[model samples]
Target chain A: MRERSDDTLETPITSMIDIVFLLIIFFVVTAQVDKDVVDESITLAQAKNAPAIDAVDPRSVTINLNKDGKINVALQPMSISQLQQLLLAMRTQAGSAIPVLIRCDYETQFRHIDRVMQAAASTGLYRVRLIAEATGG
Target chain B: MRRKPPEQLNVPMSSMIDIVFLLLIYFIVTAREEVTEAHLAVNLPAPGVAKASENKPQMMEIEVHPGYLSVRGMRLPIQEIANTLVRLGKNDPDITVLVKVNLSARAEDLVTALDLCSAANLNNLNVVTLK
Candidate 1:
């Protein structure tokens, strides 16, 4: 009977280490963290033929709505009156008409959005825009 | 100390370069280079028809409620709304009109308001839902 050799051969560790490092770098650089920050709970309505709006300036203000029908600016809850005042102040400071964008959740009530629109209108901010996700169909 | 043989010490530079290039390309392709602009936080209503052409700029927003239709907050009748929008369009040829309807608002009321806008020659109309 022939005896088998008992050499315990181990795999080279540096190559595995290098591959793991590359993967970490790839995710760190490529992951889209900003888009994820924009709340995904809101399922924007589909437009059969909505034009793509690219290169939106940062001067625009964003309002976020939750399912419970609450309005928040940059994640802070605000009343219609407060939003109106804030917009007015922004207009004054910017010296140019600042565009207003509303980001409401799909489950939000219609009246809640109406109030916000009314508030913008009363404040003389007429350049109001609504944001929705694009649909394939 | 005795040095190791050249073959044993050799590391494949070409393979390492290829891997590095692949990693660079992957990151460059996946990164979000452009800053995403923030939009209005409203859940718009889905439209039955295709969106109108973007030949004109949106100038007015008409909101429909259960009992009344308001243009910029002032309650007005369907005919009055048409007249008002026509006047506004005449003043600004590049006028875009947005009609936001409440979910509970009657379909007839919404259709009437839309008809008024269309009759006024406001072709650039968009229907949206309130958040």
Candidate 2:
């Protein structure tokens, strides 16, 4: 029978802490940027090879459209007219640099998004990114 | 005779580790959920950027109405839409695909069409409204 050595095994707390911090930092960074695009109340559109969040202008307006084609801006439901007015105001205040991010339910009609796009273009803000669920194995 | 040293104890890391692991799990789950967003970058033509084409570019039309897709006024299965678009794009890379979507149709319907268009490498696509 082999005798066991008496040396105590340390749990490598330093390395564990280092790994923990790295993971937390990664999650924190991702969480920060994704907040603008996701909403539990609205189902996201799913597409193959949808661009990642970073592909979007970080300082962009996020508009959520429910399945019924209802527009949601800044967590509140509003008519498309009101939404347009608000976006126009924002565009004027911020200029063409402020891009718009449209997050609509996958089941939502394209006209819902089309209207929003028309509104953005009318305001001279041409950059628009649509959010969808990416698919791959 | 060797003296038996008193057993030294320190703050238990087990409890702290348990809490941290819990938090780590929470963050991981939330992160996965947040990262599910697959964005489609549709660069709508800037105001005044769309000019009239002197050459009547090849045109293809697609319609969306909830459970079905209509191509060139004929209904086609969604799965085959990409293949058809790809074949069409081969004939003319300058082909323009005009997507007419039902205003009340599902967003998935539009996305499915868009995704297939993209998969076929067709960049000249537009979502139009026939009001």
* lDDT (Cα atoms) of all candidates against the true structure: 0.61, 0.71
Q: Per-residue lDDT for A22-132 in model 1, tens only?
A: 888777755655455466555554332233467776898887766566777876678878888988888788843677877765455566666776677666665566665
lDDT of 1 by residue, B29-80 (tens): 8665442332322222223222433333445889887767997778887668
Error of 1 at B24 (Å): 14
True contacts kept of each: 0.12, 0.74
User: What is candidate 2's lDDT per residue for B1-131, written digit by digit as tens?
Assistant: 33224343343588878978987787678664544565555556454454442134677778887778987677887767877888987888767777777877777877777777777767777666644
The residue ranges of model 1 lying beyond 4 angstroms of the native Cα positions read A1-33, B1-131
TM-score of each: 0.48, 0.69
* lDDT per residue (tens digit) for residues A11-84 in model 2: 45666777887997797788767575455688776787434444656567889888777887767778878888
